[model samples]
Target: MSWRRALKDTARSGIAVEKKRLEPLIAVRGAAGLAIVIALSLWLFGPAAAASSAFGAFQAAIATFQRSWRPRPELAIASGTSLAVSTFLGYLTISKEPLFLALLVVWAFAAGMSWAAGPTIGLIASSNVAIMLVTVTLPTSVAQAAGHAAMMIVGGLVQAALIVLFPVRRWGAHRDALADALAAEADYARRLRHDPVASFDPQPLMEARNAAAVTPRQARRRPAELHGARGIAERIRPVLASLADPAMGVPAEGPARDRVRELLASAAALLDAAAHAIRHGEPVSTPPAALATFRTPDTGSILTGAPYRAMTRLNTLLQDVVETAGGAPQESALQGGAPKGRGELRDQPQPTRTRPRTAPHHPPRRRPTFLALIPKALKAMRSELHRGSPITRHATRVSAVAATGYILGTWLPLGHGYWAPLTSVMVMRPDFSQTYSRAVARLAGTVIGVAVATGVVQAATPGTLQSGTLAVASAALMYLLMRTGQFATQACIAAYVVFLLGMGGEEWTQTVPERVLLTLMGGFLAMLAYAVYPAWETPRLRTRLADWLAAQGPYAAAVFGSYADPSASNAPDVRGALLTARTARAAWHAAVARATAEPVRHRGLSRTAADDAEDALAQLGRVAMLLEAHLPERGATPVPPAARFADALRESTHKGAKAIRERRVPTWDAVREALDAWETEDTDKVLRNTATLVLDTLTELSEALDTAVPPMTLDGTAPEKPDGPRNPKDSATR
Candidate 1:
């Protein structure tokens, strides 16, 4: 990618408007909170103070709308408190230019480092620096500063109180996440009837896991419908794949395969219905025909060996889903005929049979609460303190840009010196793509906003009440269109800032040119900073791949190690490895997305080769998931050679990751020999069939990652090959 192309792409992306769902109720609530704070401050302190206090409510609302799993009230309170602290400290140094400039850089740097915690924290923290600039000028004495800061906290408290008093879809995010995971499984089931060797994305499951974490206070108040449903969904995905795949369970074409297809269809319907129930908090309305298929013994008679076991397990897991949805205890949702002699269920026909009666025993997964995350956040930020880390590089870049913007704004004859630093702080992101893209967006929006606000101010010459009303309206519009891409939101925010400044008695002539010109200079400074010193994702591609490989190996070994000694299988270890692998996979995908938009070239890996390697790794994870679905019951006889095969795989992959970092082609010779040993020694058909597929997938992974490429591919598209994820999928068919 060239600089010209990059600039054009960034501009196109920055101006693009996205479709977003509007929440009229939440918007109204936030606006109401802002209105109350603005009204009180105007009556007691004056319009200038009112304009400053409005940010507390304004920022609180935006924080609540962030894509975080934490409760809205918590987000509101934290945002308000942080803003108050920034305001209080800024007031202390407002009279001294040198001290205030030092404070601004340090605050901007800390905000930049907060990205390591998550985007939500980083965004709120960054906005605080901008807000601090506005509030610092409002207070004259130290006592007045304290009172002004307290009003900010009060604004936050007002919003939080409103939320607690009138809750709307309290568990909405968690509910949607769990429902999406179940729905994804249902969609996967439908797809498998036609393509049994299909690949299922694990993103939904990972999101559900993230949503499941709660503090102790939250756990006690959590809805009954949310508990334990995610675990059942996790178990269902592997079972669906194991039953449908021909190599693992049934024949490619036969009466058994036909029965498998019907079972898959029924499972899809039932799962969809369960997802609806969970999402809406209602009773599960299952189809009688689908229930009848599971009840009829004919399907079981057709399915034998591994297929029969899959059928039995799927039936039990479905029953668990029914009992958990809407917190129903096996009412007609999924309860019916007697369960087969699956010895695990104490009673053949019991109305109260819930997850504990049949669901597999997996270790409990706990997500850390907002309070518990403090230490982890500290640790994460500490790790990024090294100069090479992107977060550190970004913090440094933004800090320099902020100080430079302040000096330029002060020296230039623009009376509102803070607008320049404010624009720079708002536009600068950690990566090249986002930083450049947002700079374009903020700059464009500022020009349009200043023009509109100037025309309105000149025509109306509005008083405090009128200006405050327009500011409130702009805020409501901003909240409503928050998801319509940053460009749309930036326009509303810009107008809102201008209206607030009008309430503070600023004329249109003085504010318009200054707002537009300062904004332009600030955005330019941020863009220039990123161009000079960038932390390009292209250089880190190999490191991300190595991390994924290192995590992927242990996950496969944990699942395979279970078959070697069923009684020794530790559910917690397997779950931990799965979570680690998912995180690593997500990191690589994010890195790829960032690297693609960059102008830098990949050191050794080409675009096409990188895609191939990513596909191969996804295939390997899919195979492991299938094996996990059919893990043997505890106390079952051990397959000793399976252990050796697992050990060989773990050791070989560890070496492969090390080779990848060294830019060398990896070898899977040990894994091949272990598979050969397993084929000769183990008569277990399940082990025999899957062992070949695993080895083939591993070999495909190594081949895809190699840097050396043929001059032309099958389709003659540069050095890119026509072969994709299907190579391993095709091998599984054998």
Candidate 2:
């Protein structure tokens, strides 16, 4: 390649890598806070005092940014309180060796259990352990320790102040999430218009939904608007999927085809408009007259076919979309107006309903006081803890390793033995994959950081000002690359540690080898702890997959049941079932990804089987979406076979779930009988064709599930084939 072309390619790759890093603004805020705190300490105190205070500020700053997504006040309070308690404990035990070792064990266990609450809280707990380890080793008086703790709190407060002064824009993350969902829906519609049988991936939409779910509700401009938009997006997916199926109805031509295309284009445009409004924090207007020409096509004419019928259904959904976008209650839109009987179809079409001319006044909501918030927060934390949870197991492992590491550190001929336990706490995670990966990264990063620190220290010893500057720079670089992956984060953290220690008047050359060796010992202990009693995703794969399969039964039943009784309200129930199934499926996919990253020997499901199962589930979701789309429109004659097919599907799915749970082979006799009955029944041609597709997809899903696991008895013991258990290599190939 030409030099210019190669250079351009290299630059593009670098930009991509940087983009994977955590938000740069967060890093800048952390660095700025640390800089201010360090500068103040240096100005007010001598070099030695400044170094001590800087240590406290650095720890507090790290804790503040550790969980940046939380509300500003909460972040500040949590970080400050956690650091103070940890620092005080460290100081208290400085003169008591046995107590210090005992507390280290207890603290490690507590930090690990904190993971049950969530990743953010767990990070805070782990960081506190690190702070305590570092602080206890420092030679300082009681008053000095107290003062240092206060400085750390000040550093956290500075970060909180910056958050309030320069807040993220209203509806920033929420708007983006909502817009992503809408855009994905619009793209799906566009694809269906061109390729009726095209396969579309639902992962993007699923991810967008997850993103929206996590967004802080208080940050949104209109919380209700987001809810309404998400509802519309979910309803639109199945409709587009059904329309894309060639078996749905007769193909339209000439003016009929053009009209159908026009409707699809209109649906896409409406979604685009809704997304645009969300992005700009404005109101969404109703679609123009061209998009509202659903009733223009005569239902009694020869041109009335599957395309026309599909377009008619599309019109109803679009009306709901427009009404929802205009701030009409989602309940009213979702119910699709009053149900229309066949007799009502003969009359002239009424104008579509829009939002009311005047809004109803409502009293303002009362915000909760701090006193009330305390109980709620406690209740939430309590709910997160349970027996046999990942958190509990992790806590047990972490505490054991920490206690062992501490004892070993004391006995080993190494200075600053606290580094052993500190490294163990840093490397351990709730999951095996994360813990192993972190251990590796921590070891490698420490080696590189030590080498670099040695060179810098030999070249020139930094003064108080120089150390402070280096600390700020390293802190920024560490956080900036933290989110990229474990390796980048560990590397930055290692470098940050070097500068941070220098500020404490430590000679880098002496500290470097000791730090590296102690880190290695801790990392090894963490890995061993996990290996002895792993919380591996592979072992949980079966349960997760079974949950997803089981959820599909209720979801399919709800969708099909809606068609049997159009006048009855089941929309909410159906939506709930669909959401549950989606969540389970997402969880299963995540588990598979984690399993892939783990060792081959530890994996339960082979890569090939996992991939096949994932594909089958995706196809199953699409089929379910198609069935939902083909639900009888208001006033349309109910197809008797539709209910029968739905019942069979529900039964088959339940049976499949039972098989998975019981660890036995799934029997397809009932499903096959349903298919036979479906073929014999006197059903509408369209409904029969759709039923065929559903049965075929279910059969495929069952076969995929069966292949995904080994043949096992009712007691869940795998029985080897006559040739004995298949080789691991063969399982992967199969």
Candidate 3:
């Protein structure tokens, strides 16, 4: 594709993308808040004072919309305070170039460190840097600086008040996340019913899980319901994969197939209903007929095989959904009458099941005060000091690049030198893909915005009032499009910058070209810095994958050990292990996504190998979840074979992780032997079946490791070595 076509395509995609529902409201508030501040300043202080005071309003508006979600009151207060301090410091150093330069450098370092806290705080800190730079440029007295700072604080306060008065539904994001997960599950089921071999993208579900994971503690009004919905969605994924297996003999046609399709449709509808209820704060209505379709599978039919197993899993999911809807599952809904020979599939343990019934009577958590948040902010900054952390590396890179841009801006003859460093700071993101993409978009948007602004200024020759109006509109547009992605945000930001600069009595024709060139220079510097000393995700993909693989062992051991020796004391440890493994898995997925976004040549693993590894990890997670779900509540099972299988699985996973780390082949002999021995040993049907599932998943995992592990050296820099013969069986059993 030509560059023009590609750019057009990108613009179309960005414009068409859907954003969070509350985003438009936040954008409007941001614009209105700043406009109010500017209007008040103009009325009280006149044109000259209003010109300087508008900078304060601009900073406040930027701070207001910097985060993906609305800030809690504590966070908003912290942000306003930071802006005030930075603005005061800027005014203090306005007369001393050396002091100003030193302060900027120091603040850049601090801003970089703030990234460890989270994206929201990182953006706030970065905005502070930008505000300080802009504020220092305007000539002002100490009194004027204080007044401006107060005005900015007022702007932020207005935003916070609006948030309190017309608060967003606390559960909106969570409800949407759960709804998306279930929708993905429903799609996968539909695909399985038609073409078993068809590929299903797991990205949507992963994104949903990540979103759900970040639910604020205060927003979790219906914790049990949220947990139940999420659990059901996760468990259904593996069951769908099992049904897709050819050996399962799921009928290609007949009553069994029709029944399966109906069950999937009902599940999807139920999920949609639950999502609507949660989003709107209404009650969920369950249809009795829909529940009945999945309650009993026809005996002596093709449903007797894998189809029946899938139905049982579906029935379990239905029960969870019903509970999440604040209704008890009828006995019929709970009991899926399978064929006589088939054993019951156990329901996974709900994470919130242990909560007391009268928990609502407990006092609510105290809101975070500003003093309390100070320690948290400091702790977050401190945690990023480690050399190996991704955020630390990113912060260091951003600081170096921004400092270089600043030095060049000072030394060069450009009229608007600050634009160079500002561009560098804005574009230098942590990951290679985002950094590169933002650089391109920033440059492109600057060019387009300059041209458009120049045409408007020359044609209309707008005075102060018109320029101010245009600036407000542009600011509102910037905030509205900000969360969509970099491209849309850059376009709007470029226009906002153009209108904002014009309001200060700068000629648009003279300033636009200089601004564009300086922005381009800054963007190029940022991209070049990353390219030269890149922290590309591809290089660390193996390490991240290995870490995830390693975590699985402890997670499995903790869960299966509980089955062998069920104890109330072990519950916390098991839960912690599960959480650890889940976190590691999320990290690995994020790594893979980042790697994919980078240039193809930088990717160490082939697409096929990466996909296989991801699928294997996902399957293993499901099996582990299944094992965790079925653990006996109180008494010890003392199943020797089950214990042996768990040990062997743990050992094999550990060995595989080691091999990947050391760039050597892994042996799975002990794992295969343990599986074979466990199969032969006398055991209960439930234990036997679960163990068989584990072994099967392990074999697939071993195969994926075989494909993925051989492609890179210890440092993940070199090509694959030519090892002797490639045999799947031998490699897996070694």
Candidate 4:
């Protein structure tokens, strides 16, 4: 897999995590303001020493910001609550009243001991420690410590309040993202139905499919949704309990994944049928024209007599799932009566029961042999392998590298360079491109922050009204600037960090430049390391796309063959072809993101090649649909030589597409072979399959035309509809 492309995509996702998801979560947690609170506290009561007090505040603020950027809702809220409660306890202790001293000690103990339980506990303990150290070590009086505590308490309270305000807003954002994912998936599914083999990039479709399946809705709630701040935390336990394999924390091996995949496939199929019906002005409530072929396999004896009728009934049973999820009561009812043998409960039978139990008095229950379901299973497997494959290794390698570097930095001798470990985590992401941008921002932010901290301390001094105003303003600004450009954030964070530091006096001249230089050096080194072993993404994407297409070719050929010589007793089975087509569709979607990430030049070629391949796959889907419908309407006689006709056209079209992608001009031999294949195979199957091939072949021709024409740029127009009758080209030697 293309590690670099994957990294870039993941990093971009991370930025979204930080911005739309993580930042709001932090606010709800209330610990996001911890940085400002710490900065203000140290500046107010800490030692008047210029660099130490200023630098300490800056350091503490940085730590707070980093730590506060939590993702999970429970963690964020827990951290915020812990920090707020801890701040209050510390204030009470700083009051130095005899009665409150015990309370303070108990609070401090709880803070430290419970830190492992949550961010809240850790923040509380840390804040108390900060207050204790600053109050005792600094030359400040007891009153000053109390004053510091008061400011922290206010900051923490404000943070807790924001949590209530932002819940719905965050949920809305999540919902929108989910919606976009669904639409994208639907679009890809439609395209897949039209032409599965044409595009080998399936990442977008897979991501979209998963995202749609798991989208937050009032009607359908997954276990993980309970972890959200908006939902009841207790609900998480039940949701988790619902999951199978108690030890592994995933659904136990059963129909859970299968059910979900089936639902998605059914939904996609139904949507496709619905779209076609509506487009052609067919009645929406009527049986889908596309589904008739799913009832029987072209190769099987199962389609004769009563079994054939039974198969048609099963097709009707499966249709509701595609029409609407809510309208699947019929499907549910059908499955409800499905026989479960010994060791199984009677009601709500599991989907995987291999054979029906004997009623003893009646004929053996034969479960419907639905061939369409094969496509769904193959599609799911293909999807799982693609989306989960490349990134698994990539994430593992990154985690290993980061962990090793962190261990080395911590255990090895590195004086005043403790920041290296932190930088390593921040900079060395799988997505190296964004790492450089983040590093640049970090350096810039650190410098500006240090400078501002010095100014605040030297000028207004902490605990004063003017200093408090600056602190609040800085906090708000920091919030606003979080995910904007790195340099803009550099200035924002720099100002905030500096204000927190005690360099407010005329001493800023000495320390400001030094901090900036050190930060720049850290960022520079991080980027350099990324470049040394940089990964490019296009290679992996190409390999995956190629693999998917290669697998699809034989399947497409088989489907075409099935279309041909319909009366041939030993025709290839429709089930296998459908399964292969579905798998190819899933694989195609999984490669989309990786393909899109490639440069325009590469993406164009890949997409064009994929589209050409899809034309053949789509024709196969159509043939399968036709065969399924035709079997019940007529007895199991040969459907005619449609398969060979389609195959002949696709073979030439595939060659043409390859030629176009390779930038090779087509010779007359290729042109002649492309035309002659269709003429030689004359039947309805031949006509439809040949027509599909010709459409794709023309698409490849257009792609090739770009190379022939000057002033080149990628043109990704929808494949043009073929016009006029099929004009047979002269037969050329292979």
* Candidate 3: stretches off by over 4 Å: 1-24, 46-75, 168-171, 188-261, 285-288, 295-320, 326-381, 566-575, 600-605, 626-629, 633-637, 685-734
Task: Return whichever of 1 and 3 wins on lDDT.
Answer: 1
Better of 2 and 3 by TM-score: 3
Give the per-residue lDDT of model 4 (tens digit) for 453-494: 766566755543344345445655555555545555556655
Highest TM-score model number: 1
Ten contiguous residues with the weakest lDDT in model 3: 348-357
Given candidate 1, what's the lDDT at residue 284? Answer: 85
Worst 10 residues of 4 by lDDT: 229-238
- Per lDDT, the best of the predicted structures is 1
lDDT of 4 at 142: 47
Rank by TM-score, highest first: 1, 3, 2, 4
> What's the TM-score of every candidate structure?
0.93, 0.78, 0.81, 0.41
Q: Which residue pairs overlap in candidate 3's backbone?
A: none
Of 2 and 4, the candidate ahead on TM-score is 2
Better of 3 and 4 by TM-score: 3
Candidate 4 whole-model C-alpha lDDT, 0 to 1: 0.38
Question: Candidate 2, which segments miss by more than 4 Å at Cα?
Answer: 1-18, 21-23, 41-73, 168-170, 190-227, 250-389, 601-605, 630-652, 668-689, 706-734
Q: For residues 1-734, what per-residue lDDT tens digits would candidate 3 score against the true structure?
A: 33355345434543343565447776787777667766776677654445555655555556655433334544555666677788788789868877777777878778877877667778788777765666556545888888767766766676567656766555566566667776676676667566553455555565455554432445444454555456556556656655543434545566665766676666666666665654555666766666666555453354654445555555666565555655543435544534333444233222233112234322332334456656887898787688887777777777777677777877888776778888888776777766766777778777876677678878988777687777778778877877666666677667766666677667776567777888989988987787677777777777787788788767876767676666556667776776678778878878877776665353445567667766666656655554554456665457777667778878888987887666544555666677678778776655565555555555565555566554555666553332232322232222
